[model samples]
Target: MTSSFHFRPMVLMASSLALLAGCTSSPRTPAPVEDRTTMGRSSTPTATPAAEAPKPLPGSENAGKPGYYTVQRGDTLTRIGLDNGQGWRDLARWNNLTNPDLIEVGQVLRVSPPGGAVETSGVVVRPIASSGPSSSVTTQDNAGNKEPTKESASKPNANANAQAMQFIWPSQGKLISKFDANNKGIEIAGKKGDPVLAAESGKVAYVGESLRGYGKLILIKHNGYLTAYGHNDKFSVKEDQLVTKGQKIAEMGNTDADAYKLKFEIRDTAGKALNPVTLLPQR
Candidate 1:
């Protein structure tokens, strides 16, 4: 009985050790896989979008005739008129514009007179015809009474200065040069910085240095008539501004000239050059 009890205790202890070894030898299951692919909420920056360009205005070119002008980007009323050689005020008046600065891009505006007709407001009176006393004509009426007919009749020469715009001296200076075949205008000598006046009431058409040999110039328009003042040192009036006769518009200078002077000109409604002396009042 004692030998059997010892053998049974040894068997029980071996079975307990086998169970513990099996538990340690078996591989442990891998821990739950971590979600390493997930990232933070913040992100990288991207490029910004670019701005769009302005659209171009549309129109056609018809020189010296009634036509339309398209208002383009960076275009003002004065700039449009200057480019077309039309006065800003005249353009505004012709288009019935109540506000000159309210022009918009892509807007069409009138640039000529209605029906392309030349405006004439002045009357030309003809000189009386001289006749000898014996050249009188007699007309006999139905009642047998003789009556003398009228001799001198006044008529207008439409081709002559019938609607010419009158002008005055642009500056109180000595006439240094007169208009000639070689020159389209006259030059008046004056001191530097002398006041330059407008020859007639009109709208400021152009004000810039675009024209060669005319430094710092200002162009004015009177109806169909156009006047130019050149070699100015300073401009008092801007483009599109209304100026009256004798108004100080600029300062005389020697820009593009050998001496200080003012270059003045008078152009017809069609841009033909005219003698300034004929239009200007006698000094």
Candidate 2:
């Protein structure tokens, strides 16, 4: 019986060692974990940029005010007078400039007459008959002959009576383009050497290629308006020369244009470009 009891204890010890050996032979594996350091940041969107504003034009602050003009680069007294609807001589007299050609950039000049009243050299009168006289009592001279009326005695100034002026077509051709926000004038498509006529009676203000995009340009200064003829292959008029309505001023060509054309524009005294079609007569 003692031997059986000792054998029982030895069997229990063997079983305990076998369990420890099995535990040491194999270890449990841990589960895998995800990396979330930049999880939300990777899915985030970026902000969009804002749009830029348009740049203001030069001398825009003085727009709509006709009494003054700010001299820009490449400006001359004649060009300024043309833009302001006055003669160059008149501009010289108004500003009392000793040298009209000497003008600096950003210099302010008086565009309008002093006290806002234009000075005249001679008197203008209406005919007595046209004045609604009740009787036809003609004034006889000492020679017993009919005396000339005051209307015949004095001639009216052309520049003073320009509000009633009219305009005509500058060229005969198909209108390829029209005036818009991007285009300052209308384009008339024509063959090279086609006649470009003056839209109204005026004195030529500028004649040259100085103006960009307007090749061989001619700027005519009417009393209250200014007309432009651009992209001409040949010029028929010179600067400071007087031109009547329907007079040939230039020849259509593809100077700055892609094709043979005449670009015509009409501007006010303030140098603001206007749609020429509005002022031209209907075909």
* Per-candidate total of colliding backbone pairs: 0, 0
Q: How many steric overlaps does candidate 2 have?
A: 0
lDDT of 2 at 269: 67
lDDT string for model 1 (77-114, tens) is 76566555566666788877899878876677876667
Give lDDT per model, in order.
0.76, 0.76
Measured with C-alpha atoms, the lDDT of residue 29 in candidate 1 is: 93
Instruction: For candidate 2, write residues 138-208 as lDDT tens digits.
Output: 67888899964543333334554344458889998999999998887899999999999998877886787
Query: Which candidate number has the best TM-score?
Result: 2
TM-score of 1: 0.50
> Model 2 RMSD to the real structure?
13.6
Model 2: pairs clashing at backbone N, Cα or C within 3 Å:
none
